[model samples]
Target: MPGILGHRASLPRQLAFRFLPDGTDDAAVEWTYHDLAEHAAAVATGLLRRELTGHRVVLALDPGLHYIAALFGIFQAGATAVPSFPPTGKRALARFLSIVEDCAPDVIIADTRLADRVAQFEAELPASAARPHWMFVDDDWFRRAAGARRPDGDTRATVRTDGPALLQYTSGSTGDPKGIVLTHDNLVSNCRALEANMGYEPDRVGCTWLPPYHDMGLMGTIMLAVHGGWPLVLMPPAYFVQRPYRWLKAVTDHKVTISVGPNFAFDICTSSITDEELATLDLSSLRQVFCGSEPVSRATLDAFRDRFGPRGYDETSLIPCYGLAEATLYVSGKRTGSAVKTVWLDKAALENGRVRHLTAEDAEDAEAADAGRAARIVSCGEVAEGHEVIVVDPGERRQAEPGRVGEIWVRGPNVATGYLGKPELTAATFTARLADPGDELTYLRTGDLGFLHEGELCVTGRLKDLVVIAGRNLYPQDIEHSVRSAHEKLRGAAVFSVPGESGEELVVVTEFRGTARQLAEEIDAVRDAVTAAVTAGHGVAPADVHFAPVGAISMTTSGKVRRDATRKAYVQGTLKKLTPAADALPLSVR
Candidate 1:
């Protein structure tokens, strides 16, 4: 139940905090536990003088030492910290403002670079409403606020274990974003659980390049390193996107022992790295490559191991993990030194609620006949030490048999209480129940579709209409179902979710009984109709719509459309399709 500041008082004062090995920025940013405590006290005093207590304070800034200081300062002031990304465009900016309006934060501590943009957006607001006071994180502000005064020695204040510690907004892949309320106890419990599960030591060195706005980046990389008293190397997300090889080079250069990212990052690095860059790097110190944030692919992992093995990378370093913001950070992870295990199954049988593991020979034969494409699913390993996982049926009343797909439910001291400000939704999601009839416990519904296979969790899909593309979620069913109802021929049509270089997109593929001559016109008509429907329904535009002849759409033996298969085929350029119009409408059109 103790807050981060409370722990800091008891933690070692001389523990190493962070290391900046890039040598690009000249910022002398290094702090010990004592320095952190002093800076947090200064920040707390500044906020109290401004009459900002027991209110939400948004932290909208880039990653830096000042950002870290301000984050702890907000917590020390007994206020909820809302960590958010910088607004990129008009729509994103509007959404950010809306969230602030709803939360009614007392103040905002933002970077100087975004102060003008925030002011311009605020000016557009209607009159007669309370507006958040803003303060810029400039050099003058830091000198004034951090050097002004300190909290009274006799005033003893601290956050309870049940008090809100953070307000993390959902990715907004669905409708509007919801604020996930995380308490001090929830974070402390999860961090301890992760430490015990992964066997983290103070001597370990962590390196990561994921954006700080994400949950994995904030909790897994930053909080874990700080709480464990380990030295950490930080890299911007842009640096990884621009040159992925630099990430590997950093690992070898710094002798990083632990790293994590999505599966796409590995695939990109493996496919794009040059032989010359690989020759100069030494990766022998790399002990764990934590893979998560998306579906873990065995092909991607194997390819990475093969590509970097000769470069001193260990084959057993790849560890697939599973976690979400609802549980703070981690749920499960494979053992440290074990090679990833995958089971080859008959694709047809899997769709019919039956799972049969196949022999290696049978797997090879199927791949050979299908031009070297096999169905290999990897396990996410066992649940963390203090956490419990259960596979439950739709009624939420009974557990499913092994190998039978169902919703994944989690229960533990680390599970969060509920969403912020939505009591009905909170009651619906965080339910009270026991695994056994007489056991006293409760579980949180994850809304993730998966099943237990030999005591390992195998995630298949999502129960919600959430589409995850390139490690981001997208809501397409709401748009697709609306589109279908708008056009008569498209009724009951299937909407396919696809990710491109830009981002995740929605593709409405409708089947119609028509000849090639009429297909072109029908396709255009359907595209226009669906585009309008989605724009009106969701305020977002569809990327494209392709019309297919009756029976042209691929389906499983049981007649369910293989949406994943369809997406893969489209990405590989193997899907036969009707011709698109020469003058296709732009994405902004309604």
Candidate 2:
């Protein structure tokens, strides 16, 4: 099996970037295959000089060309790369420290720009934590290392095919982050599976503004482009957040044929981009726009199409895919050339762990087609080649019946061996087996609730995130979406269950987007609307509707609403209340 490093000599010199320091594409940096290879070789020389081979090297740099160089450099030096978010502020620094403690890296490589913050982070490290060697990548270091060459031997022999290549950490939406151990074979196999599943053209150009530290950005885009031998234009996630239009503009300007983003990105583009900006985009060149890392919203997909379709954005270009860090990113992606498929099912039946497709007759029946009775689920396409995906009854540890929602289990070369340094968990999660006889393949339990409809995977929700009240399982996303739709002022919403006098009660924490005066005037009305929406949609009224300050809702790095974390904040009374006046709604302190 050829690893990523093997492509160093075979790939074309085309990957480029438009450096946007001040949100302007003034500096054009075109990095070719040779350029990246040479830079990576120099970085490898630097690492080898430090005797850091076969060690964990954590990257704490901004998303850019230098980060890519450092990643391949670690591969060339036979060291495991741990891509991490830069410790820019208190929150990020805390997460970074937690990752450092978890990985216990031998060295920490960061950009020179983070010198001050890095020093502070180092000082804050606990006494029990091992002090890691520090190296900073900058123009000066690159200049000094440029003269160094690859070790005198067959360059391909530098990295073992089955050895650990990366420690891709989870985003920790549910719990603490765990490093998924991906070997060189896993990386190459996943990239190949992506290519096999989603046919890649040699002349294809890619673009992305996703955070490079995450799996979708690193393996899905960066590593995939390298393996596919294509050019990829890059930009920081902050720039995209500053203006969602920049992402499409880059796609249009570069004639990008492939791109990837989460569901919130399309929603942001739909609501944020003006008609003037929409007119400037020519998204017809995009053959596939992969959406994953969170639930793919039907409303978002339809709205994005309705808004951008006139501007040549192909409806068929948006592909809903399913994947995670444990699968080395690309799991299963919708094939191109067809519009995305969505199945409207009875919400009650779905909540009961069954797939009941809503028929036209059901729609005609007024009582049956009540508001929120139908749940629209988007198909995540077929399993990748050489992979087996099965819905397993988690409790029974047996294969789920047809059309029954269960934990998605995957077995393939793309699946990672296990979580790093956790044997028991690794066995429990990555070595699952069915109860049926004559079935011997070990499967990785995805912990996602989904069922196969026809041949397509329709993900319902996460098993742990499901809210069971009165024996009815409610997906938080459905409740959150309803709450957001309840009022125009409602922006971000998180729905979770809390211990009540009863078994559990639903709590809604939301952020409003209007002035404080406007909120004060509409506070009572908004609360009433939210309560009605949740009650009508899920048959469960929220015990309390709390209006939080802007940015109060906890979100994962990949833009998922961190319901569990937000619940913790709600219980601790740490959530910032949106109090406009004396008559404002009182905080429902737990």
Best by TM-score: 2
Candidate 1's C-alpha runs over 4 A off are 1-29, 124-129, 151-156, 371-374, 395-397, 432-440, 465-590
lDDT of 1 at 27: 39
In angstroms, how far off is 567's CA in candidate 1?
13
Candidate 1 local lDDT, 426-542, one digit each (tens): 776787564567866678888876777778788765665456444433333334446655676652345666666787777766665455555555555666777776666444566
Worst 10 residues of 1 by lDDT: 19-28
Clashing pairs in 2: 13-33
By TM-score, how accurate is candidate 2? 0.95
lDDT of each: 0.68, 0.84
The alpha-carbon deviation from the true structure for residue 361 of candidate 2, after best TM-score superposition, in angstroms, is: 5.6
Give all TM-scores, in the order shown: 0.76, 0.95
